[model samples]
Target chain A: MEFLGSNWIVVVFMVVATFIMGFAMAGISSVVGPSRPNKAKSAPYESGIPDIKPVRPQFTARFYVIGMLFVIFDLEAAFMYPWAVNFDVLGMGGFVHMMIFVSLLLLSYVYAWKKGALEWV
Target chain B: MGDQPIWITFIVTFVIMIVLLTSMAYTTWYERKVLARFQDRIGPTRTGPAGLLQPLADAVKLMGKEDLIPEAADRKVFYFAPMITFITAILAAAVIPWGGTIELFGQSVNLYPTDLNVGALFILATGSIGVYGIILGGWSSGNRYSLLGAIRSAAQVISYELILGFSLVGIFIITGTMSLKEIMFRQHETISFGPFEIANWFVLSQPLAFVLFVIAAVAETNRAPFDLPEAESELVAGFMTEYSAMRFALYFLGEYISMIIMSLFASTLFLGGTSGPGADTYWPLGIMWLVLKAIAFLFFYIWLRATLPRFRFDQLMGLAWKVLLPLAILNIALTAFFRLIGNGQVF
Candidate 1:
């Protein structure tokens, strides 16, 4: 019991329990579940309908560009939240930390912008 | 509950575990509903009264479906992937302080399952390990799409993990503690608001960090706007392309649980978790307040899914490595400098 109350033990219990339950449930479900094989049924379905088009084709690169830009700004934006929450307690030190982080990220953003990574139609 | 601290821990943990599992089930339902709303259509209102029983029905169907492992797939690694995912998700919850301590039979037990000193670090490590499940699952699938998904997932995680670690470094520096509980207590302390006093919330002090955390967290969980790993349109359900039946469900549960864990961490770290407006006024209420706060963040996640678009893969990587990482570094330096200044010491 004392061991059970310990942090490490509790963590162990949780890890083990979740895996076991998932496995057990999965195992039980698979054991009694129906199995029927057919060529049409096995084939992949798209948008709730049978697929008639080719499997792969090249798409535009614009999505990648915008995605890169979004990710860059999105991440840069995330670091600010924690720094803002602890601003007063951190005072100058915290602000300085944030400034450095933001500035460095800002530099990358600028470079990306110059490289035409932010463009979209 | 008296003279049964161990038993109590078991019961509480079991109940919490059940709650998490059930919540994860419904989160899928929620995601579908939200996604449909975004696309402007009615989603899953057919089964069990407005689709309330949809998740349960889905579970039953998944259970009843045939289990399949491609003959070419590596049996060992393929089997282990979902297990790893499930395990890592549950590991993060260990340090979450669900509520403050409660008195039971004249003995007080902390509301959290565990209070490890390196709780934050533990979470980070667990998150790192979680990526492996995706990687291995994709690799073992022996499918090109699955392999590509795994590669993308690996790159995504690696890109974001640095920024994620950097963001937390700021929090650690400010709180001067790695323990989540300590950070929570530090929040419990207050600052003067003129003649009156106001309980310090991290949101006010660390807004930048909070925002960064939310963004990085969303990416880390591979949710919408950062869900390139499992992007259905491009990758045909990404890493789980060949996974079927309950194996698929394990991945599903792993994802939702990860989201819940992220929400809890965000609330605890930035939203003054469990430490409410008048936590000092009454101790028990502190935990209730924390739950409410965590719920708010959860809704926020759901809301983001409802409103946001998924990012391009390259864009996701660029943000993590270039933008977020640098900002996180700057954040840490700023937080350190301000703490010194606040102490009235020259640094």
Candidate 2:
């Protein structure tokens, strides 16, 4: 709690610093930079040919699948960290508990693999 | 730690910010020079002596160039995306332990900006947030190639992030702490084998985790071989294809700074940050040691960029999901098994 209280200041400072640096750079460039926006210049670059369709085309479902799997595994990894940090204190109980958790996750991984969900195609 | 004067903390934070900005500028020059050596050609010799001032010249040129916005672009998202990238990249530095505490003007000051109990998790969280810059930038640009590039980047970062997080579980297990400062302090003690003493760096004990961490880190930063995000041949400039002038520079700055941050994290986690020989006798030596380790990692990143060919997109994703992720999980299991047996809690 004490750490959080002191560190929030640091966090706020960092956030403000990032914004200041970003805006300062943007402002300087905008002030100094040339602004000659013509019709050809403003169009999106597409190998010199004009764009025919809208940019937001339908993407593959694989990306969505990867995202779902990532969330599940990322959560697993997140849970494992706190447990790992206290492995000594947790002793045998923690070891067995983590193994059970991991084994269940591994089963899901295997199921994903078997179902071809891991395949990029 | 909370008792320190707020002004003093601000000054320290400002100094670190300056250092990060300067280093971020020089890293581009460093990469070019090193890449030139690897390719048997001289790089950027015209700007200043040995091109030491090339970054300054480049900054001036970028600032003077036209700031272009595409007609079809989402103006707000396009403009702020780079800012998002730059912000997240810089935030991760707040928790890094640059060195042990040192006495300045008869007052002890920690070398780190702020020490958090969950410092490691803070880094991971910030890293995850960085992807938004790429995704939103690419999507808002109204360019098909940019969208494809962003999708590739999003997938790459997400997959490898798991490996990166899992790889560090070994360190957290061994040290019994997530605070980088505590981990560094833990490494300061020497371990002996037969009559020889060795620094108790996590790299020596957890070699697999170190390897996995480095691999995933490279992918995480979207650097070469893993640089499918900005494959110049295919996607023009990736998410920054529509960006020009300072907007593009923000993304560029974000990339290099993230590389440096990852190098710092690697050194802190595996190489016993700031804990080299002679560091105990002179505290400043600890900072020097930390800087040296980080530079070595940065050089390694540049070397790999110069040497390795980029992987195909499918191969890139496959390596992360099939190889690195599983290996990371195995590493965690192995760590748990050894720790349990060593403690006489299993067997």
Candidate 3:
């Protein structure tokens, strides 16, 4: 228990407990709630019209583009955390390196902005 | 309950969960009552005094409602997804420190459930995991509205979540660590200015980061104004269109729990968690202070919901990528620059 790493045991216990709680909350409903299912009730809700087509609909390409940019930028954030944590030890040199790293990412972000990659309806 | 062998962890976890569940339930009531006041109407008043027991009433009512699973839905995924959301949201709260370590019955125990070295990042990771519930649940529901909700959530999270990650870099630079307890402790310290002594709260030093964090945190939780994922008018409950009974409650719990957790996280980072008059001497006072600060943040969340309209998906994305992200990055650079200069490491 003295070891700092052992604290995660509490975390694991918490997660498992919370997950069970989630299940129990829903399970209670399943056991106690009414279950008279009809075709109208089972149908997927889309205003009032009944659907013949499959549920798979095409999404905009912009979501994909945004997802890609997220990967790039959040990874930048991940990389920067360590540098930020060690800011004092690394000094001016680390500062300059991080600036260069961030500026390059910003430049790409600006490129995306100018290219209208960020535009959405 | 005094000393136990290996049950300390269980006890701590139990207490934290109780606190979170109570707060989460009340947050719904708080939002409705506050929002109603904003609109000059009375909210739920018949359940209990001032509708105080409305959450309990709502929970009991939801239990009697039919558990409607769409015939075309993927049974396994829909069933599993809500658990993912609820679990991850509660798990994130495990890292939030209620106060510093203290002694009771000759045993020293930490005030929080657990203090991880990467406590802040742990919250972020859990939040990212919570999104999967919406994405998978929506896609597996076999509804077009739910699918659109899923797509919007994916896009919204990617943009807002990125800024959310970057917004904390300034705090990391200022505190020189990612452990939320240490950051809170750092802010709790007093500094001398002329003849005045004031807390070194990060909000004062990193005002820009604080502002950016508040915005991103709101968007990250998918709350009102940022709640395009569940825009009732446009998407009819969004990803939850096909959900019924307590399955819907699971998502509701997830959202409310995450809201309280984010408020706790924000109070810890910016408002000096567990810090108040005599808090250092009496540890329980610290918890009181933290709760007060978290409640203030919760009020802010409700206020925003009442005051503002939902953002267009395009505008939401543009704000994240174009405005908040750059500002967050700039905050990081500025903090690093000044931090080094303060240390006499940079001229």
Candidate 4:
């Protein structure tokens, strides 16, 4: 098993502290604040008219396309992080290997850009 | 790296928490005052001397205001969503190095909370998940405008986040480490250039990456010019539309805190964080430099807000995919070639 370090302990404390911080902010506000409720007040807010709309509206394909592209490119970038961090030890051979890999990803990116899949209004 | 006592660690962590929270509160005041001066008006003059207590007063007022939940809202998600943004933003600050270790009461106490080998990656990962709060909050509000706002934000965040990650790739390749503390220290190594001695800050070598990073960081924080999600004229505060009182206050806090964290993150990565004249002899000067650099970046953020117009949605997406991505790739390729040259692998 990988040994747990002191750094992880500080991190845990930080997580716990911030969690409490959020709760304290919200909890104090809820307790100290008033609770006067009415129909008009509870309605979903908008600028002027505040009209109610259809529930869970269907979104266009543009969002999903962007999401998928993000997943693909983000993964490619994630793969590069370790390689970049080890660049010095890895030397010229690693440099050539990474360049080839990144160029392929860029080519694919270019293909996506040309396919009209990236267009949004 | 040291086996410090658990109690001491706890105390240090607690202090860091207080600092992050306090800096976040003051950042709001700083932004307002800076923007006010830019517009030729004094901001928050009545609350206290120079309105220094305005953030405190605002916090009390917000806490006292009645909390509201829309009748059609998902009560659980709406209640919890703001916390997601708040926690993630606050968590990133834990890894930021305030300065080198300081000797405190016969004990060597590190100025930073922690230094993960994957510190840079940790910040980016938190940033990636940070958008879920917006997406979920908007969806749960049960309104079309909220839904649209969420969708736009999801798209915007993902696109810009890619640029943010890629921009750092140049620094990673140059430094050969993802640890923020290590990156900062690496930048402190001076290289002589004829008449002038210069510290090897990444901003000097990888200038393109720095520019890309600033643009991407501003968009990630949803500051003006990139504040499409919360564009009041369009989506009416976007995912924040259906929120009020304490929940609203948390989101507001989260944004400002994220701004501060991003500023610190940028300084740590590119500006030779905590490395300044006299910083070697007097350690507090390092912290002072860190604060000054972060504040400068924060000022730059407010300046952009006061200067630029918001980008159209399509234009924002296009710039990320078409412009920034290719430039980032080019930067990586150039850095790699230079690395090879430095390694004596190329003539």
Off by over 4 Å in 2: A2-4
The best candidate in terms of lDDT: 2
Q: Which consecutive 10 residues in model 1 chain B have the weakest lDDT in total?
A: B1-10
Q: Model 4 over residues A1-121: C-alpha lDDT tens digits?
A: 1236777777777778878888988999889999998988887775556665657569888888999999999998989899999888888888888888988987888788789877775
Backbone clash pairs for candidate 2 read none
Candidate 2, residues B1-347, lDDT tens digits: the string is: 54567778778888998899899999999999999999998898988899999999999999999989999999999989999999999999998887766778987777788889898999998999999999999999999888888988999999999999999999999989988889988888899977999899999999999999999999999999899999999989888889999999999999999999999999999999989989988978988999999999999999999889999988988898888888888988898889888888884
lDDT of each: 0.75, 0.91, 0.88, 0.87
Q: In model 3, which residue pairs have backbone atoms overlapping below 3 Å?
A: none
Question: Candidate 4: where is the Cα deviation over 4 Å?
Answer: A1-4, A48-53
Docking verdict class for candidate 3: medium
Ranking by DockQ: 2, 4, 3, 1
How are the candidates ranked when ordered by TM-score, highest leading?
2, 4, 3, 1
Shift in Å, residue B291, candidate 4: 0.4
Q: Is candidate 2 or candidate 3 better by DockQ?
A: 2
The segments of candidate 3 whose C-alpha lies over 4 angstroms from its true place after superposition are: A1-4, B1-6
lDDT digits (tens) for residues B1-347 of candidate 4: 45556687677767877887888889999999999999999888888899999999999999999988888899999899999888888888878987767788988877777888889998998887889988888889877678888889889988999999999988898888888888988877898989899888889999999999999999999888999989888888899888888889888988998899999999999998988898778888888999999999999999999999899999999999899989998998899898889888863
Better of 1 and 3 by lDDT: 3
lDDT of 3 by residue, A1-121 (tens): 2444567778778888887888888999999999999999899897989898887668878888988888898899889989988888899999998899888988898898899988885
